[model samples]
Target: MTVISIPGSKSVTARALFLAAAANGSSTLLRPLSSDDSEGFAAGLTGLGYEVVREPDRWYLTGRPCGPAAGEADIYCRDGATTARFLPALAAAGHGSYRFDASAQMRRRPLAPLTEALRTLGVDLRHEDAEGHHPLRIEAAGIKGGELTLDAGESSQYLTALLMLGPLTREGLRITVTDLVSAPYIEITLAMMRSFGVEVTRGGPGNTVFTVPPGGYRATTYAIEPDASTASYFFAAAALTGSEVTVPGLGQGALQGDLRFVDVLRRMGAEVHTTADATTVRSTGGLTGITVNMRDISDTMPTLAGIAPFASGPVRIEDVGNTRVKECDRLEACARNLRRMGITVATGPDWIEITPGTPRPTEVETHGDHRIVMSFAVTALRTPGITYDDPGCVRKTFPGFHEAFAGFAEILDRRGPATRP
Candidate 1:
C-alpha cells in the first residue's frame, strides 16, 4: 500500500491567486502549485505590476485590488486557460492597459464568448492576431455589469470567468447562460467565492443571477484543498493493479464536486473509506465496469477510460459532448489511446464505451494535456510497458505526478537531459 499526498488543486490555486490579486491586502497561499501553467498565471500578475513572491512551497501575493501598479503591461498567459479567461476580466476592471497572448495550443482554444461578454461590459479589447481568439490587447476601463448572455456549451470556463468577476463588477452582474456545461465546476466557483465572504445567488436550476456588492473583495487567508482530479490517477492505479492506496487531504466532506469519483470506484469493486480529512481506496477484488453520465464531471472521463480495459464488462461514459473543447478533444484522444493498447473502445459525439481486451504495451501521446498523461500513467501500472511522449505535460496540473506514480509503478524517464539510463 502506498500513500500519496498530492499538492494543492490547480483549479483552486489559479482561482485563489486571482482572488488574492483582487483583494486589498497581502495574501499568502500555502502549498501552491509551481508549474508552467501556474507560473504563467503568476507571471501575468507580475506583468500587471503586482508583487508576487515565490517561496519554496508557498506564494506571497500582495494585492492591489484597486488595479495593477503600472496600469499597463503585456501579459502572456502561456497555455493556462484559467489565466487566459480570468485575467482579461480582472484587467478590464482595473485602470490600466494590458495585452494577453498564449501558445499555439491555447490559441486553438476559443475565447470569443468571454471577450464578447467583456465587450458588452464596455471593455476596450482588440484582437491583435486572430479575431475571437487569443493575442488580445485591453485598455484599462471600468465595467458596468448588467444583463449579459454567454454561450457556455463549448466550455464552462467561459461561464465561470463571468461568475467569478460578476462580484467585482460595478452593478454586480446578471449572467444568462445558454447551454451551460460542467455545472459542477460552477458550483465549485460559487463555493470558493462564499468561503472568501462573497455571496452568489442561483436563481433556478439552469439560470444563475449573481449580485456582487458595491464594495471590493474581502481579504482573508484561505487554504486550498487537494485536487480530486489529480487524485483520480492514484485511485485508478490502485484499481488497475489491485494495490491499496490512501490519498490524504480528500475525504467525504470535500467541496470539490469531482470527489464523486469515489462512488464510481466503490461500484467498480474498490473498497472505499473516508475519514474527516483523508480518503483511502483499495481494490479488494476484480473491477466490474459500470456506466456513468459524466456531464457534470467530465474531467474524470480520461482517468476512467484508461482503466476501463481492465474491468469485467463494458464501461460507458455518457453526456460529455463539451469535452471536445478542452485542452484537446478528450473523447477522441481516449479512444485513440485505448485502441493503441488493444482495447475494444467505441466513441461517439457524447459517449464512449470500452470493453476489456488483451493487455499490451503501447506508446501514448499526451497532446500536451495533463489529464491524458496522468490517466495513461495509471495504465502503465498494470500493462507490460507503456511509454509517453511529453511526460512533462503533467506540469499543467500535477507537477509531481511522475514522482507520485513512482510509489506504485516503474517510471522510466526518456526525455531530453532528464533521461535516466
Candidate 2:
C-alpha cells in the first residue's frame, strides 16, 4: 500500500495562530502548516506587533492577552478568509487604528456578517470600499462585549471570529446564531478553544446560543492534524484508479469535518478501513455513484466532482451554497471545468450534478482557486494531457502539492493495478 503524508491543517493552524496571539503566555505550535495562508496570518500578526518566531517544525508566539502591541497598523490579508475575518476582530479587541485589506479574490468575499457583529459589540468598524466588503478600517478602543444575534448561513467564520473574540471582551459574549452552515467547523473552533483553556457553553433551542466567558485564553502547546480536505484528492484518486492508499494522522480522533469525505468514497463502492490513527481506502471493485449532502463538508465537493465521471451512475452534491462566496464560486467552477473536459455537468443555486462519461483531456481553468487545481489534478490522473492555468495556486494551502501528488501517482502507476491487495 502507498501511504502519503499530507500537510498540517490550514484551518487548525490559522485558529491556533489567533489563539496563540491572544493568550496569556507564549504558545508553541507543532507541525503548523507552512503555506501562503498560514504565512500570511503569521505576517499579519507580526504587522500588529505580535511576536512570532518560526522554526522548521514549530512556531512560537508570545501572547499579549491585552491585544496587539502596535498602536496603528496596516494588514494585507492576502486570500485567506480566516485572516481577513478573524484578524479584524483580533485587532478590535486592542486599542489602535488597524486597516485590513486583501487580494481582489478575498475582497470579493463578504465580511459584512462578522464586521456587523463586531460593530454591534460597539466596535468602530468601517468598510473603506463597498459596504460589507474588505478594505476595512477598525478604530479599536477595545470591546465591552455583550449579547448579539448573527446570521452565519453564508460563512461560519463570522461566528468563529466572534466566538474567539469572546474572552478578550470585558463582559464576555452570548451569541445567538439564526442560520448556520458548516456546523462541524464550529465544533472544531469550540474544541480548540477548550484546548487553549477556555470553555464555551452552548444552549438555547438546538444549541443556537454560544456563551463565551471572560478571562482570555491560556497558552499551551498544540499539534495540528494533517489536512483532511487536501487528503480528499488522494482518496478520490485511489477510488478512481483502483489503488489502495493509506493516510496516517486522520483517524477517529481527527477534528476536521472534511474527513467525512471518506464516507462519500465508501458510498461510491470503495472499501475503507479506519484505525485509531490512520485511514485507508481501497477500490474493492468498480465505482458506483450516489447523492450526498455536503453542507458541513462542502470543501471537498470539487474532489467528488473531479472523479464523478468515473463512477457508473450520476453523482449529485447538495446544500453547499456557501461555496459560492469562497475563493471563487466553487459550484460553478466545478461545473464549468467538468464541462470543458467533455463531461456532462449541471449546477443549481447550491448543488452540482455529474453524469458518468469518459472524460476528455483539457486545460482546466483554475479561477485561481487552490481547490480547483487540486481537485482537477486528481481528474488528470485518469486522463493524461490535462493541464492547469495556474497550478501554483496550491501554495495557498499545500505549497508542494504537485510534487507530492506526482510522487504518489508515479508509485501507483509503476505498480499498476497490482498495487491493490
Candidate 3:
C-alpha cells in the first residue's frame, strides 16, 4: 500500500477562518489548508481588520469579531467560490463599506442570490457596473437579523454563508431555504461552527428553517480534517490503476461529506475500508460504470467523470446543476474535454452521461478550474499520453499537485496501466 499525506480540508479551513474572525478573542487554526483559495480567504479576513499569522503546521489569528475599517474594505477572492459567498455574510455581520471582487471567472458565477439575501437583512448593497456579480459594494451595518426566506437553488454556499452569519446578527436569524442542493456541505459548516463553540438549530416544521441565536462564535482552537474531495482523486487513481491507495487522517469520523465517495467507489466494484484514522481504497478488479447523483458529493463528480471512459458502460452524473456556477461551467467543461479524448458525452441541465472508449492523446484545456485540471490528470493513469496546457491550475487548491501526483503515479505506474483494454 502506498501512503499519502492529504492536505487539510479547504471547507474546514474557510469555516475556521470565518469563525475565528467572528469570535470575540484570539484563536488558532491547526493544519489549515495552504492554497490559493485558502490564502484568498485569509486575505479577505485581513482586509476586514483581522490579523492572520501563517505558520507551517497552523495559523494564528487575532479576531476583530466586529467589522472592517470605516472608510473602505476592498477584499478580493481571486476566484474561490467559498470565499466569495461566505465573506459577504461575514462582512454584513460586522461593520463596513466593503467592496468585493474576484477573478474574471468568478465574476461569471452567481453572487446575486447571496447579495440579495444580505440585502433582505438590510445591507446597503450596490452593483458596480454588473448586475449580479462581483466588484459589488455593501455598506455593512451589522445585520438586523430577522426571519427571512430565500432560494438556495443556485448554490448551497448561500445558505452556509447565511447560517454562518446567524450567530453574529443582533437579533439572530430565521432562514427558510428552498430548492436546497448539496445539503451535506451545510453540515460541514455547522459542524465547524460547533467546534468554534457556536450552535445552529435546525429542527422546524419543514426542516428548512435554521435558527442561530445572537451569540457569536467563541475564540478556540480547532483541528482541520483532511480534504476528502482532494483525496477522491487519489482514490480514483486506485480504481483506475488496480492499485491500493490509502489517505491517512481521513476516516469514518471525518467532517467532510465527500468522504462518502469511497462508498461510490465500493459500489463501482472497488474494495473500500475505513478506520479511526484513515480510509483505504483497494482496487478489486475492473471499474464499473453506474448512474450516480453527485449533488451531495458534487466536488468529486469530475473525478468520477475522468474515470468514466475506463469503465465498461455509461456513467451518468445527475443533480449537479449547481456545478454550472462553480469556478467554471464544470458540466460543459467535462463534456468538451471528454470529447477531446475521443469518448462520447451527453449533458443536460443537471447531468452528464459518459461512454467508455479508448482516449486519444490530446492536450486538455483546464479552463483554469482546479477540479477540471486535477480530475483530468487522473485519466493519464489509464489512458496515458494525456497532457494539460496548464497543469499548474491545480494550485488553486493543491499547490504541489503535480509533484505529489507524479510520485503516486511512479509507485502505481511501476506496473503501468493495469488491466487496461
* Model 3 root-mean-square deviation: 1.3
Q: Write the per-residue lDDT of candidate 3 for residues 1-421, one digit (tens) a residue.
A: 9889999988889888988888888899999999999999998888777789999999998776565543478889897988988888888776668888998988888888788888888889998968888888888778778988878877888888888888888889898877788778888988888888778888667788888888777899989888999999999999888899999999778888899988888988899989999999998448888999899899899999999998878999999998887888899999999998899999999999999898887888888889988898888877678888788888888999989998999997676558764
Candidate 1 runs further than 4 Å off = 204-207, 410-421
Best candidate, TM-score = 2
Candidate 3 lands at a TM-score of 0.97
lDDT of 1 by residue, 109-198 (tens): 889999999999888999888898999999877777788877888777888787777766778888777677777787778787776667
lDDT of 2 by residue, 265-363 (tens): 999889999899999999853778899999999999999999898888999999999999899999999998889888999889998999998789998
The CA-based lDDT of model 3 is what? 0.86
How would the candidate models be sorted by TM-score, starting from the highest? 2, 3, 1
Candidate 2 backbone collisions, by pair: none
lDDT accuracy of residue 264 in candidate 2? 93
In order of appearance, the predictions have TM-scores of 0.94, 0.98, 0.97
Against the reference, the lDDT scores of all candidates come to 0.81, 0.93, 0.86
User: How would the candidate models be sorted by lDDT, starting from the highest?
Assistant: 2, 3, 1
Which of 2 and 3 is ahead in lDDT? 2
Candidate 2 lDDT at 137 equals 98
